[model samples]
Target: MGPPERTILGSKASVRRPKERLEREERPRRKITVLPTGRQFAVVRMDPLAMVSHLDLDSVAIEEASAIKPKKYLVYLDAPQDLPLPQSQWCRFWVQPVATTLRPAVPEEGITSDMVLPIHPNTQYAKGRRLMNCTPQFPFPHCYLWIRSMMSLRVRTKRGVDVYDNDKAMTVSIDSHVAFMSAWNEDSRRMFALRRAALSSLSGQTPSSEGKLRKSPSPEVVQPNAEHSPSFATLSIPPPLRIYRDGSASSDDEDTSQASDDAESPHAPTLPPIPPLMALAIDTDVFGWAADPKVPFVPLVDLWFELEDHLSPDNIPSPVELWREQETIGA
Candidate 1:
């Protein structure tokens, strides 16, 4: 159960319900599809900071962009659109969303490429010489769609690893208080997710633990109420995933921490809260080592995503103001 609903993008919950939307046009060879399942969303790739800095939230329709705690969806944008070339030989696209949420699974004790993402034997570099960057371990062709929520178990990378010509939908289900995202192309250390949490408690408090604070594990996860608007929709987090070493994969239900060690997670450094009105800046490593160890890799790929915490004090009324009954009626 949750509190009463609040209007988002200036609209009510009824407006966010799913509708029979028309299928968008697609180009040959390349594809982009938004399932008519959850709330409406706009997916485009650009330096979010460049656009958000000039964005006027007041001018935007107050009728809620999505539900208060919106159901997530896949924002497929793998179109062959022209992207600005990187300064060097390599380029990276670290996918992040301003309005979305996730609960990143922490990297377990022992993790490998096959465990992180599936490795197909037939489609791998051994068989497909034409496939660039294809390694004995890393077989994925390009960055695809993925969604990691507070309750997700494993990734879909392995869903069709064995199926031949398996064009099986590597789709994502955007559940309530969930997140939709692009494939995680970075190493295990850098892998993290967005967290859908109550920002009201975090609004006043600064980070007490090394400029960061995490939610304590609870059996009953708090579900966001569409009726209530939070200061921010979600949080970026270092969550843990199932583990497998010499044995098969299994969940260590006893552990509740995000990542185990510091050195193990250099990519996901301890982050500070983004200042008021500033976008959350994140860098994702998209490096692919070459065959020869002697060859020096000059240009390292990195994708940057600047996230704007749309939920702020200015938009939502303070609790003190909402409950204060006009100058206090003399105690």
Candidate 2:
């Protein structure tokens, strides 16, 4: 009862306050070092609902949003398994068709008799043949446009468009006009083919940005002497992955040879004849680290898919396939 029983007002607070408990429990964990070479790996937690908020953070570097473009995808008949097509014939066939017609998206007025394909290429009995080229005579008549038209029709028709697993697919829906445009241009057709081939390969491999551009052999050609030139594809790319199994086989053979030379060898009696060497190779490429810490990079496949969605409709992948193999690749 002495000194008026000291009343401690602030000490009356609860030991475990709700706010303190939440602050302690919900705090984000500190980032940890990653493997191979242990270095701190930064963590970025972005909520879909709060994307803008995260994007606006002072620490984040904002890039100018690129205008989204659609990818171009063109469909043509696949080469028949039995029929081996000569390169020259394939090139020649693209230029002319017996009954193939051309209706330009923007047919120029100066178009004379020389400007039209005259008639569509007669592909009636041509097994495994498809018309993909536009007549050169037509002013600005693009083959891609025609192909896009055809693609659009097919995509909308009863026979649903069925693209192969490795086909080059864009994000945008392949509309009628785009398909027609793609059909009218040889360059576009080649691009489509190259992309398809690369996509097929990349579907099984790890997706990377630089790899995609370098994926297809460069279209560039360089003159050797005065007259002839060679495509970049002909130029040797130092083989990325060494045929290790081949080396192993060679080593085994060398070992066998050495053993034969030595008279004293145990268990040398018919060592299963080396199992008739079946060759295998691990395909690999060297990835260089960036020297500068400031620059950010994006993968080529991602860029390609992004482009496919906006500018060109032909490159977009089919929805069903996109959903199925999305986890497996650049899709």
Alpha carbon RMSD to native, model 2: 24.3
State in Å the error of residue 7, model 1: 67
* Candidate 2 positional error at 164, Å: 12
Instruction: For each candidate, give its TM-score against the true structure.
Output: 0.18, 0.18
Which digits, one per residue and each the tens of the lDDT, describe model 2 over residues 66-88?
21222222222211111112221
Report lDDT (Cα) of residue 313, candidate 2. 26
Off by over 4 Å in 2: 1-129, 132-267, 271-307, 310-331
- Clashing pairs counted in every model: 22, 57
Error of 1 at 196 (Å): 17
